[model samples]
Target: MASNPPAPEAPYAPVQPPTDTFGYGGYRTDEGPWEEWNPTAESIRPVRGKHRVAKQRGGGFARSSTVLGVGVIAAVSAGGMASANTGKAPVSISMPDLPGVGSLISDDKPAPEAASALASFGSEAAVAVDADADADQSVADAGEALRSRIMAQAESQKTQVEVKAAAAAAKAKADAVVKAEKEAEAKAAAAKKKAAEEAAAKVEAARLAELAKQYTLPTSSYTITSTFGQAGSLWSSGYHTGLDFAAPTGTLIKAVHSGTVTEAGWAGAYGYRTILTLDDGTELWFCHQSSISVSVGQKVATGDVIGRVGATGNVTGAHLHLEVHANGNAEGIDPAAWLRSKGLNP
Candidate 1:
């Protein structure tokens, strides 16, 4: 038999880099030179200067999604490899150390150096996202607190205004009540004073009405030519001591009140005189009369004719000279005043 053909290689087998320990190697294949690469802290660090990564347009969402998808794919590949080798003897598989090739491997500690850097980048991105969310929540909470404070202040102001208005209204009502009470009191006082004055006037009127029934005038249709207390040479006294009523000759004179005739006769200078003594002992002298109509000691009623007017005692004209002596006193009082006391005008 012909010698067995050389074992066929898998089409997608990983290419191994040349075993060189220094600088760059010039290993070539159909795709390109399989350059050797070794990961380091400096090589894995993010590029700066002119070779720096450009900033993403929208946000970090695309970067985060890419990182998450890579992690998921690595985890799934690791799980599949573990399952496939569950009952097989351990075998050593070699892979080339090439530029950018470490990122595609799935292992327990996948791409050791590069994985650590990617994890650091993912952690920083997560931290940045968390910090932004926290900032947004803080601002929203502060705004809500501010709105609450404003509402509380508004309510407080409204309450104060209502309280003040209520107080003002109460004060106004109280003032009105006090003013009304004062006005009522004033009206009551005025009414009381008016009633008292009217009552006093009524009593005075009643007293005068009663006096009118108990007395009578001495004569009528006569003119008072002279008044009591008149001063002239026509009287024997310094002043007129009686009232003078001048009338036509022979006019009748009447008794002023019910009384007894104490004297009824002509005396010197008294052409015809009559003296009436009342029950109270007051004497009424009617002098210078034309004639006496009653005798001495005769009882006469009020309004009874007692004498006639004539130009008699110290005569000047036809008139009656009437004098009043209270309580039998010889000195006479004003006849006109005494007549008024008994409810007569004159």
Candidate 2:
């Protein structure tokens, strides 16, 4: 111990390791009479190694959900492609039930075994992709069937509507045609009725003109002194039943129409009266005449001289009293209305 020189005194302090660029944990350096103590295994716990939480490319659960969504999209896209390529109808494709990848992630513990399970799921996903084409064909078939049914229903409805519209149009057209026909018939009937009336009027006018040519006035330069049905004491019956035409005593009288002389010369009260009988059994009496020009049974034409006007028996002045009896009726009708029936104004 004397051979070695004494060393410098050192302060009592904890030992510290040398500094280095490489970071290292410190080591223990103690020299003392200390006994090594081993704590109870139950009291002390084993320290676990420090570990880092590995984040997925996105969040773990979110990335898992994204993968599942991508798979579904791929399946649908494959179905569309199958429908386009194959002429055959497609059948429905049911997706296989899959375990959830998000449930495998944990906040506290790392899941190394879950990664292996995920690798197995990846294999299963590959199998699903391989079978996707067939599944797409089935789904396309089902869609095609549904579309065909809907199209058929629509086409049927359209056809029904068209038929109804056409029927209605036809009915309306028929009704219009019938109405037009009826209207035309009615118009034609009206026109025919008007034409017949015009023709009848024209025929009547011609007949009247011919009758006027045949008929003649009883006397010229004479005036109507009295009409039929006059009440007076001068008449023997107390009522005049004849038309009286006044004139000078020698005025000439003529036959009104073609007729036969039934009686001529003096009839006591009528005074040189002439009786003319027409073809229709109408008797015309010219009373108070000065002279008679026609004999009994003599056929006289219309306008032939029959008598002369004079004041004779049963007369107040120079006048011709004319009476008419038709159809053996002794009582005479009004001469004015009777003359109008033959188209005469007198």
Candidate 3:
């Protein structure tokens, strides 16, 4: 039958497993690594239709593996870069409040590109903090300037008030001085008035004293025959009640002191009489006249004629009777003593 296949070649040479002898493990040659064995169409038969076709055409499991590996590496690199950029916390910053910043930050509305550029460069909280810091600094500087101005104004006002107070105090002191001076002037005027009154009183006293010195008795300088207090009865009643002057009748009579003659008329027991009264309280009576020459209330001087010497009715031998009374009372004292009391010699 086809020569019977050359006697079947030793029972198909007893098929054996492949072995590795070189370090490449591609072939089992003992001297060195050999080329890896690849089967050709001339050596092997083709596989079944679709599975074999998929291997020769391009898109296979190997291409799918290469694409999946590249994608994995790219994703890993992107994630690592983002982590590096995001890890550092922002540096600390101080700021003042910005206009509309709080609204822009707290609300969901987005700002314009100009605004958002500044806004997004920092965190929303960081934006608020920067704006607030700048605003706070500006406000503090403005406040300091305003405070300085206010303090300066207050100091100026205080100085003005002090000046006004000083002026007022000076005015008050001047007014007080003027008032004191006026009071002193008034006191001086009162003192002068009082001194004038006292001086006038002294002058009046001196005038009254001088008038009493120059009066004498109204007779021929008669000697004392019967004094004012001789207590013996000579003719009538109980006592010699009249001062007797043993003078001739019709002797010219004179006034004793400057006075007014109250009466020059007839009397029953003392015939004719003249009554005279002087200022400052002294009374004189010339009794037993030969004739009457004066009437009531006739003014007379120290040496003027009032009436003649009298020796009528109850008189002995043409003698004159004289009487002196104090304050219209008939009480008697020594006539010579009373005349001396008036600074007059009888």
lDDT of 1 by residue, 263-323 (tens): 9887777667899999999999999887788999899988889888888778878988899
lDDT of 3 by residue, 1-346 (tens): 3554555443212112224211123433343222223323464354456552223122233333333333433333334333344553323222234433333222245356425543443454455566678789999999999999999999999999999999999999999999999999999999998999999877865754675655766688565677664665665656666567677768888787888787778778878888898886678888888887777888887888887775677765676677788788866546667666655666
| lDDT score at residue 299, model 3, on the 0-100 scale | 81
- As for lDDT, the candidate ahead, 1 or 3, is 1
TM-score of each: 0.45, 0.45, 0.37
Worst 10 residues of 2 by lDDT: 31-40
lDDT score, candidate 3, position 46? 47
Model 2 clash tally? Answer: 6
Candidates' C-alpha lDDT: 0.74, 0.73, 0.63
Off by over 4 Å in 2: 1-188, 229-239
Task: Note the residue pairs that clash in candidate 2.
Answer: 90-137, 90-141, 91-137, 91-138, 91-139, 92-138
lDDT, candidate 2, equals 0.73
